[model samples]
Target: MNPELKLVAARQGGVFSRAQAMAVGYTPEQIRERLTGGRWERIRHGQYAERADLSALDAWEQHIVRHRRAVHAAMNSMRPGSAVVSHHSALVLQGIPVWQVDLAEVQLTRTSGRGEVKAGVRHHQGRLSPADTTRVDGLTTTTIARAVVESAARTSFEAAVVSADAALRRPEVSAEDFRRLLAVTECWPGSPAIRSVLAFAVPLAESAGESRLRVLMRNEGLPPPVLQAAFNDAAGFVGRVDFYFPDHNTVVEFDGLKKYADGSREALIREKLREDRLRALGLEVVRVTWADLLQPARTATHIRQAFDRARRTRLAG
Candidate 1:
């Protein structure tokens, strides 16, 4: 590839259009040769990227990366400013964590025309005011608040809450912003569910696991737990917990890999010590892992058992 095409591909998330290759002095045969030789990978019709640019990534990360490249490719294929990236695609572009949302199609919103899906892109027909859209990484996309609401309207409640919680953590996003967007999209399909998501979303959720656990607890009819609750003992601040059931005197921690990324003995020992301190403070510690979340009923049972034990211990005292 020439310097010109290299620059173009770099600007578009390592993707380039067929026309761009030609413009940069590559013949169609040359492009075909590169594709056949496994040097260039086709992102979509008329869009290609160097295979080397698509590095090995974990399943989730790779999905996001492929979706991002597809988004850029779709944008490149369309006329400039014809559509803005919206919905889950916008959330991905803004680096917001989304759970269980479809990334198979790049989502775009246009000011007019009926919505349609074609060539791995979904175009949504909606009114996007200036306030509802912004530029993320040089691509026009719906604002975080707008994106969250749009996504919530189309996905499961659990998925919506996860994205909404992450979006709320952004300084530029607020509950008011979501409410305003909600008012605009009030009559749309699934608006009520979006409303519920906004009401449930909190900026305090520090990770997707914590957010999902909160949703599961609600769905299972468990009492709402205080998020990121701090516990102190005679030694000082014991630690901040993921979820705390004040009435039950129990602490629920979402044990995701992020907390134990190092997987070191010392890290495990420190966590054990932290749980011991919480126990010393008369709090029942219940740990929830990603696997536990997959079985909501079992997880809820475990938490309830902890609650019962804490209550019994208190009564015994």
Candidate 2:
């Protein structure tokens, strides 16, 4: 690869157009040879990326990386300022994690044209005022608030809440920002769902797993638990819990892989000790993992059993 072309590709998320390769002293035949040799992979029509970059990512991460490169490719091929990245695509560019949202097609909002889907790109025809649009990674994109609302309008409630919760955690985004966008889009389709997401989204959620767990609790008819509640004992600060059910005297902790990413025995022992201390305070503890979230009914039953145990212990005391 030419040095100039590598620079260009680096600036565009490791994607380069065919014309860019040609300008960087590569012939059409050579480009084809590189693609065939697996040195370069095609992202979209006439868009190519280094095979090494794609192969370096894990399967799940590769999807997002490919979609991001595709977004850059799609935007580069379009007329400048003609459209802004919107919806899930905008969230992607803004670096907010999305859950269960389709990324097969890059979504854009045309400033002045009818909506259409062409070549894996979905052009949305909607009003995008200056206030609602911003630049992200050198590409024009919808503001985080608008992206969240637009995304909520089109995706499942769980997916929407995940993105919304993540967005609210950003310093640039606030609950008020979402509310303002919600007010403006009140009559828009899926406004009711967006409203529900706004009402439920909290900044304290630190991971997508936690957000999904919250949605599951709501859908399973569990009473709302306090978020990130702090616990302490006479020794010192115990730890902050993910969810605390005050009335039930139980605490639910989301056990995602990141919690134990180090795979250290000492870390596990520390966590066990923390649970012991919480139990010493007469608080029943329940653990929720990604797998447990998948089995919502069983998870709810387990939580209920913990609540019953706490009640029984109190009675015995």
lDDT of 1 by residue, 128-209 (tens): 8899999986789999999999998899999988888999889999778977887898899878998899988999998999
Model 1: ten consecutive residues of lowest lDDT: 50-59
lDDT over C-alpha atoms for residue 296 of model 2: 93
lDDT of 1 at 219: 94
Candidate 2 RMSD to the correct structure: 1.3
TM-score of each: 0.97, 0.96
Tens-digit per-residue lDDT, 231-251, candidate 2: 889998999999999998999
Evaluate all candidate structures by whole-model CA lDDT and list the values in order. Answer: 0.90, 0.91
